[model samples]
Target: MQSDQLIVFAVLAATLGLFVWNRWRYDIVALGALLVVTLAGIVPPEQAFMGLGHPAVITVAAVLVLSRGLLNSGVVDSLARHLTKVGDKPWVQVLTLTAIVALCSGFMNNVGALALFMPVAVWMSRQSGRSPSYLLMPLAFGSLLGGTLTLIGTPPNIIIAGYRREVGEAPFRMFEFLPVGLAITAAGVLLITVLWRLIPRRENQGSDQELFEISAYLTELKVPAQSKYTRRTLHELIAAGGDEAEVMVIALVREGHYQAMPSIYEVLRDEDVLLVEADSDSLKRFLDVTHLELAAEADSKAEAREKAEQEKQAEKNGDTLAQPDANESKTDRHKERALAEAIVTPGSSLIGTTATGLSLRERYGMNVLAVARQGQRLRQRLGKIRFAAGDILLLQAREDQLPSTLSNLGCLPLASRGLRITAPRQVLLASSIFAVALALIAVGVMPAAIALVGAALAMILVGLVPTGDIYKSIDMSIIVLIAAMLPIGEALETTGGSRLIADALLEIGQSAPPAATVAILMAGVMLLSNVVNNAAAAVLAAPVAISLSRGMEASADPLLMAVAIGASCAFLTPIGHQSNTLVMAPGGYRFGDYWRLGLPLSALVVLVAVPVILWVWPL
Candidate 1:
């Protein structure tokens, strides 16, 4: 009830409110809180930015980079192919996919793990005629469960370990979480296997119509006057699309005259609009190699001309940035391009503009293949189609530049079926580097952050990850959120806010047994995690758990374990975890759908994790 404590509590309350309101970005809100505390004299100005360089933030960034390397190497894809052989049984398929995603989560970032396997799950749902909702939630829940097994598995573990170091205890080792984590993960996976039946099977979830709502099948492009394809026959045009870009010319519209199903021997002409049926990747390659123009507003062509003029001016002025390496240019020119889908975020620059207006190819080295906007059929050309928030775009780009390109475009990648073009030797090299990092951490050769940073650097050195994209692989919002929350967490400790909360908990636990107290604390933290970001939950709860244990004169080990486990078990809502939200639109799921499986699975986690923690850590 001190004035300083009251001020800190008020700031904390506002921070939590903004997180739930979600009107503003979470990282912005967190940065605002950090500034408020520093200006109020609660946190010294000199220490205000210390959280940015914290080991936890560094480790999380490194993990994300390493995960991207793993994904690009095609190692996870090779392993997930085995699940396809499990046949069409829903039970067998769900268990197999969930187990693989969960197991991978123990070593890499769990959300990354979920991303890798999502397409596989959707593929299985299609093959088995099961609703995607039945499979996606279990995969998400399993990923959350898997992250609890290792110190580097999730950001919360790294943050909690950093907290332990600050309190004069050795940081938890790499496999310290395995005992309780393994128990809960094994039991939860089993329960999810049986209980997934409770997740209703929406008949439309796997329908062609639902799939088309997110991906368009046909697109129109104008034949440019200088194009080699102008004199070619319709049959020749189809042949030039290549296997990766297999397409069929469905119609020819010339000078506003629509002709359906042009004959194979029919000749093409300049300014003819060809209607074609093809996936995003194929369409891009066909158009690029054929030098066709997607119809666009005149502004797009003008923008491209302006950009080209700026580059020429820079070169004339001897701007070092304007020069591209000869060898690098040669390599890029020869690099094969592939197609992928990205959804425009609410904050995207692409919103309210057509792709041609954005000058995507000239600006970012990417081609917009097709766009899907629900409840509307596009009557215009691809480049002329105006984009809106939530429109999924199929883009074509060089394989190595895809991640950074997506980040730059403010888009989240969607699960798409395509073969990874990386060679086996490169994949092996990337996998070996990752294993070495894990081994170094397991033997205490270095801190987790240092080991991971080294591994990511090695991946770049070996050409597993492109040097230009090293920083892009790291999600800046996550880094900012971690940095900003750390000081807020420390302010809570210094202002005695943590102790006040601890004393209230101690009073309640005094009348109950220690085991019951642990369960109550665990349940409370889990609920807090569902409403707020899990990383913030861990940072706020760790100190209170330490105080609660001291007040009870019990081992701090069990209490800390409780906090770590509870902080990661976010379920019961899509907003609770990023993994859940990633699957919502793809699965065609509604808001209330999560509670059917999440509520029971959450109860199972508390029931199994409490006994395992008490027995292993011994309160």
Candidate 2:
């Protein structure tokens, strides 16, 4: 082994270990690896950042923005609304939902597609009175299947195309993947639809109350005349509870007027009713410290009736509920407060941060009323709980700011029923722009990245995607991961490391038929993807696949296609892909639950993909 190969191999091993350790973020790990290799002189410092300009990275970012545009246009939402009419059968619902999400995944970011449809799937589960577990896993698997359909569908396809270009061939055409991808997707979706029973039917699948049981922790307390905190600001009152207090004051009612998510700066008055969320210990401590008492059941019932009568009278007068006083400005009437449930998205910055650390209430003006993970409410101190991807938060915020807040926080608001359609003109314009870009790519008139970027820009210009949201729509962590990992992949090939690894793989399959070698290669990459990010798996495996092809005296196209298909087969674990992770909490899936369906689907992909790849891009 040459010195450079040894160095590259060491760095690669450490990088993979870090990825599997799942401690640091993948992007940070990749970036650190890139810097290490560059400093070691394995890759020239001058060319270290060149991967940032790679077309694959550009296409992924553009696709994300375009997906947001499609979402904002409400075109997909309109289509998803009709899913309720798809009927009550489990198989029919699974088939229809998976197929649509898969089709959408082919054109846009697969994770984005999955996020958009999750709420709809949950709503469907609720309406049909079934476990969401049956629908969510299939939905996630479908998104992965869909990504195989286009060059821009997933980062791996674009990365594979870039590798093809390096091998002196035209990059894979936009729909060139459709032939093999369509077949694999068809097989996978059918298996999921027919073998839906493979997914575990976990309890509390569709009901938020069952999942979080918020009522168990929510207690209404009152500030009496002698309470020391009565005249202080809400912030001061909460501060009085000391650092160990886990309670949150979610709402305040003063003389029959309700304030949802009242500001912490609001002053507490005598006789005020506070709706608080806290565990038993925290509630007792908070009450002890603040000298506040739990509202009597009689007072609570009377207050409920009084509030209901006020709402009834307001409705009779054609006024909005929670009407502001005459002295209040019109802006107060339009404040539109709401309490909603949101799930933390994969790659969210909030994953490791605590509410106190982020100053969520002070900064985002939202109160974290309660949180649930994997179908059970968390009983620990709320302020100290570190957020994790797929954790469900019960948030109270202004209705208008909720969307952007969730977007900024990298969370997805759970669907609350019904579809909201944007203007017809925006819908037509967004669809037309996307169609034109696809047409351009199909005819070879423009490159995939350029055409898609142009389409994204057009959407921004036309207000289909808000200017404020363009950057937010792009998942920068993914972009950085791809950019940073690209040069490392090249270094593996350039340093002869890939060839060295390829030689060993070739020896293992020397006696096996070439078709078996393809299966082995695809299956190996598939397993790697199940642990690491799929794009990183493709990057590391692409060079090895290319080298393996040369040693076998075969064309590189079939091998590269295998790498592409294998990279997207990140089933068998929630951590394998963002789509899977995003559905875990909502579906009440355990860590081991994935493989029950994933194992079979993975096998099906290998069985269907190898023959199709051989027939389409023969060795």
Candidate 3:
């Protein structure tokens, strides 16, 4: 390679090395690379940030918005209710949920699929009395595997399809990847189910209590009953009963026994009793509400529930695994609330703060029902446990609070999971519009970019996706990275860096057979995917694959397939794929944790993919 090319190569290498080192934000790394190239005169100044406007960037943003709209409709949560009922057996639960999540990801966004299922998975972990750590990692990995199977499942696939078009060919058909992708998916899901067990168990594993430990129900209350405590004001109520039984008056019941929420000033009335949820020991000797009202409600249902438990113990004979699904006799529990999947940002103040201290309930009017920290189940004493960065917090709040609360918490909501199918009225319309756009692009009626832009405009005009949130849905970091890096890739090519890299591989494989060249291409692309972004890796490696194939005078399919397989196998590191990073905070995963599971998965992909690629598309 010439000196100028070497300079570009050196710049690209340093940029990627720093990015993997993660000393600075990845977007900054990409920008720095482009600036270095421009200052070095490898590329003109006009080309900097050009990739920001690329079609891939725009489409990714639009898709994210559309996914958010889907979440806002409450479709994903409803799916959880039905799914949790399949079976409570560990493998059975994993199989069913994994399949469900994968199917969800295949059609929708994979990240969304994982987000939607996260709560449900946590619930399952609680009901099963297992550590969530065992389940969540598999869930994350499964979602990643599923998304790779479909064109819309992941962005890299979309970018590859777009690149295929730019190379003077039609974009990939909707299911073009099924042949290789499905096989990879099958292998991946199986690996997770079986091999995931091989991962070392962490400290304090296996707690069923985490899921059931929803927000503490402690609230202030004026004692009332059918005259439980007459003539007591709200101020007097807390003082009288709070010592023996901890109760704060959150609200009041008023005249004619109306259960309207009360203000602080109201006096307790005759026959009115305060409602409270407290620890049983503290409530054992309480002087609050009339014993009759409190006792009656508990004995009727409580006795019956206790009797049912006894009967269940006798019938099952200590076999808890076969017990009914937690929601087998479910009621209408879901309400008009905003549910979101937010990752605790690395430097967030919310880490280590519980729901009470953060005033999530009092301030934001939301509840932090569950905190997914790495593989731990944190369902109990939530107010007391310190949160950490990288935990995926499952929050519930009024629809309006989501925006501000998220901003305050320094959390990034997963774009894909909260898809509410609430707008069933627009289901056909929204889906049809998306499908039409996809079809138009796939069939070459318009550039994928034009079709997506048109669809986004149409979606806005029709009120499918709201006009306000359209921009927020797109991941600007990714768009910026792609935009900044595309020119860098171009510079790499222009400066002959890519060619030198390609020649070195070809020369390295000179003594080996042509099949080995394909493996080298696959390995090289996989490394590229691991260090840079996956789509960027695919774009960088494709021409290299083609060039090496031409040099060896062989069919390019095997080599190209190698590049494709390697690019999408973003297993070894979080930076390789957004979905991987998306789960990091929620899973409480350290930057180094992914490679522990992913390194093997990536190797599996290369090994399985190489033989398959060679067999299916002979060299």
Candidate 4:
């Protein structure tokens, strides 16, 4: 090999090593490698930054935005809610989930599809009493299958289609990939539903009963006229309640006015309602002994408690305590449980969606309490500041509705998913729009790049993802990786590295039949994909396939298909795709677990994709 080619190889080796080690963010590592390549003169410095603006990179960013718009429009939200009723019927659940993810991916980016559907899968897993692992891998795999139906579905397909221009071939026609993609998707869906059951369940994942476990309760205390405790200090009440009640006067509500969290020595007064955080057990004891009825707690238990208390007080006061008017008490009870607190989780529903915009109070009958901003408490008006991925929110709901409200909004309960966003809607929407753009491209209505970029702009129109977040979703690391590796791939051709490898394969199986040649190419691309981005794998292997064809003086279509199939079949590791990285957190997975199912899935793809490619593409 030429020394320049050797240097390129060293760059790839170091990049992969660092990627595996995860010493730094993947994007930074990729850029670092690119810089090294530039300095080493492996890639022309001008072209070194070319990958950042490559059509593939631009298309991915735009597609991501479009996916966001589809979700923000509530198309994905409505679909997810419907998925729940059908999500838990075992094999039926698999079919439903697979079809949804696959169909969604066909129109959006694959990662976007998986992200959109991940919550539903998690929700399904909890509802069906199954591990999310079962559904997530299939959802991810289904997304890949779905992407193949169109040119813009996944970056690999786009990259491959785009590269066709190098051969003086028009890019793949829209729906050209559909027949093969559909066949593969159908077979893949069948395998995942049947064979995915073979994957062992993970431990430490929270089940349904544990999903919404509430660790804290925030309620309001109404200071009534003639109440003997009205003059007490915050410390006095806390001391009296002991461990039974821990009190912080979050706010004092007077004449319907609210204050941000109050101070420790804040004096109490008649007609003032105070928001306090205390255990349910202690709060109940205090209410019973002191004769202050919890008007709010009863929005559920309120009716029974208020009546019982009035009857008891009537016997003592005779006149002042006659049954408190039922309507009056109902209103009071509804108003009672007015404050609740939950820590926002990284994956929370509130991350991208806003409270005022979502009609949270009207739709879910809940109100925003004070927001807890980790080391910093929020001073901005709670309703004005947009909810972020990691900010904690204190909310108020009728005590009885807390569980359902939390679950419905896709917010993980504070005790469990503190300060993390659990909402997957943005991801889902991003995927859907991406898929649609692909459909448009596949049908030849527009160029694949234009279709994808349009979808991303659509995302901006709807607000599913923030302006800043649009850039955040691109996975610059993968972009860099692709760019940096593009030079390495160039070197492979320059030094005959790919030719050298292709020559060995042709030598071993030169006489073996066409099918064997297909297999060798398939294996080569799959191996390369495991260690690099699938697009890079396809790009590197494509020239070799063409070279091998030149050597054989035969048809190269089968070889091309081999590279395409191998590029998408990166099932053996989480590093293969962002879809896999996404599930890593929720699945509670170790890096090793992907191969348990991925290895066989990959083998199956080769076994299946090869024959189909040969039959369809011809020798």
How many clashes in each structure? Answer: 1, 0, 45, 41
Looking at candidate 2, what is the lDDT of residue 297?
59
Better of 1 and 2 by TM-score: 2
Give, for candidate 2, the lowest lDDT window spanning 10 residues: 326-335
User: Over the stretch 1-619, how does candidate 3's per-residue lDDT look in tens digits?
Assistant: 3878778778867876887786676777877888888898877888776777777777666666667655544555566768768767777777667777876676566666776787677667667776555566677677767766756666676666655543455666566666677787788777777666654444343463432243354322323345534554554554555455543322233432333224434666654534444455545445434332453353356558876887888777855434445442111122223456567754356866766677665566565656676645654444566876567666665555575567566675643233243556566567777778878866667765677678777777787667666765565666777787777767776666666677888889989987777777777778878777776676667666656666777766667667777777777666666566655544445667777778777777776777777777687
Ordered list by TM-score, greatest first? 2, 1, 3, 4
Q: Tell me the whole-model lDDT of each prediction, alpha carbons only.
A: 0.79, 0.88, 0.63, 0.65
Which runs in model 4 stand beyond 4 Å of their true positions? 216-440, 443-446, 454-480
lDDT of 4 by residue, 1-619 (tens): 4787677667767877876675565567767877887898767777777766767667666665666566555566567667768735678888789888887787676766676677677667876677776777777778877887765566666666655655567766666666667777787888888887666576444353332123364577776677776787644554565444434344556665665444445666776676655556656766665555453652436567867887888888776643445466334433444444344433345766667678575577566655544224455544466875335456766566775576455444332221223257655666676567667775678886787677777767657656765755555545666666565556566666667777888898867987888888888788777766676677668778867766777666667667777787777776676666556545656678888877777777777777788787787
Give the runs in model 1 whose Cα sits over 4 Å from its true position. 213-271, 276-415
lDDT of 1 by residue, 451-498 (tens): 999999898888777877787677787789889999989988888898
Among these predicted structures, which one has the highest lDDT? Answer: 2
Candidate 3 Cα deviation (angstroms), residue 538: 3.1
Cα distance off (Å), candidate 1, residue 27: 0.9
lDDT of 1: 0.79
**What lDDT is reached at residue 428 by model 4?**
68
Q: By summed lDDT, which 10 consecutive residues of candidate 3 come out lowest?
A: 328-337
Which number leads on TM-score? Answer: 2
